[model samples]
Target: MADHAAARTTRSMTVPLVAFVAGAVVAVLLGVLGRVHDPTLSGTTDLGFRTVIEMKVVLATVIGALVVLQLLSALWLYGHLGRRPPSWLGTAHRVSGGLALLLTVFVGYSCLWALGLEVGTLPHGEPVPLRAVVHGVLGCAVFGAVVVKIVAVRARRAPGWFLPVAGGLLFTLLLVVVLTSAAWYVAARGWPGPAGY
Candidate 1:
């Protein structure tokens, strides 16, 4: 009977274990893609922005905003906020979370496809900026964080603590991704124009 109980305990962990592995795979794949892919490095405008980089910053800012909503909604749901969250809060969280995920994925792919990693050498170009390099890496990490969070939410046997931890991690990663890219752009370029707002 004890042996059977132990086996059950181990079995219960399988979902989280799989989620962890999936997260690792996501991080590794994005890192590899960022490192190996050839980039366009074009100065073309996107969505009326002055450059592709500018468009990314705009999208990233929106993602950051959405993640803020996610954090607050999660907090309320977890009772970190006042007693009894509204019924609509859960629905709002889902909607915002979905939007945040979609935007994050879009920006990440755009970066990977358009700029690759901000590599040490850029053919005839100068050395890659450290900020750009960090931004690229953080972008890759965001996908990994997202994978873990999604798995925690979807898995039937995930531990009670798993979802909150995953949610917090996703929030932090997304916030940093925004800071490293969009915040830096705003700091240097002094806010994007009509397209950015």
Candidate 2:
């Protein structure tokens, strides 16, 4: 009986252990990629910078909301909400998660293509703002967390908590990215670039 109990504990930990290693690898790889990857600058738009910023902000906000829904759905599926989950709960979770991922991919590509990793508009000698630096770091982290979440979800051996943990981390990183960039842009330049300025 004792041997069986020990084996079960070991088995349960195997997935969590794998998840931890994968998460670490993901974070490092994403950071390196963000640093070394050159901006494509292929995203063409007749609209001005302010317009682009506004559109990105709107999309990000929507994505963030969807992520919240995803979290709730995950909780429901996991029975963490302390109630019976609806039949559609799983479908809702999957759909919202997919939508969020798709939107994030588009926004992330556009951002890197247009803005690169550099922080501010100041001259070369000027110091980079702390907010920009934080945003950039967190941006890379967002990619890592999302990848980790995906891997965890697909890992059949992984523990159920692994998915929720990874998803939560991704959501947090995304919120920081949105807050540091889009929210800051809106605050600095209003919703639409101060009306033709």
- In model 1, the runs with Cα more than 4 Å from the true position are 1-5, 41-45, 124-126, 195-197
- Candidate 1, residue 138: lDDT: 76
Question: What ranges in model 2 sit over 4 Å off?
Answer: 1-14, 37-40, 44-51, 119-123, 193-197
Tell me the tens digit of each residue's lDDT in model 2 across 1-197: 99998887788778767766776776566556655667665663424544555667777878878877987888789888999998988988898889999988778766666665665444467877899778877776777777788777887766667777888889889888888877787788666544366
In candidate 2, which residue pairs get closer than 3 Å at backbone N, Cα or C atoms, i.e. clash?
Answer: none
Evaluate all candidate structures by whole-model CA lDDT and list the values in order.
0.83, 0.75
Candidates in order, TM-scores: namely 0.89, 0.78
Give the least accurate 10-residue stretch of model 1, judged by summed lDDT.
41-50
Residue 114, candidate 1: C-alpha displacement in angstroms:
0.8
Tens-digit lDDT string for candidate 1 (1-197): 99998887787678778887888789889889878887775533387777778788899999999999888888889898888998999999999889888887777877888878766866788888887777777778778888899889987776787888788888888898899889988998877777546
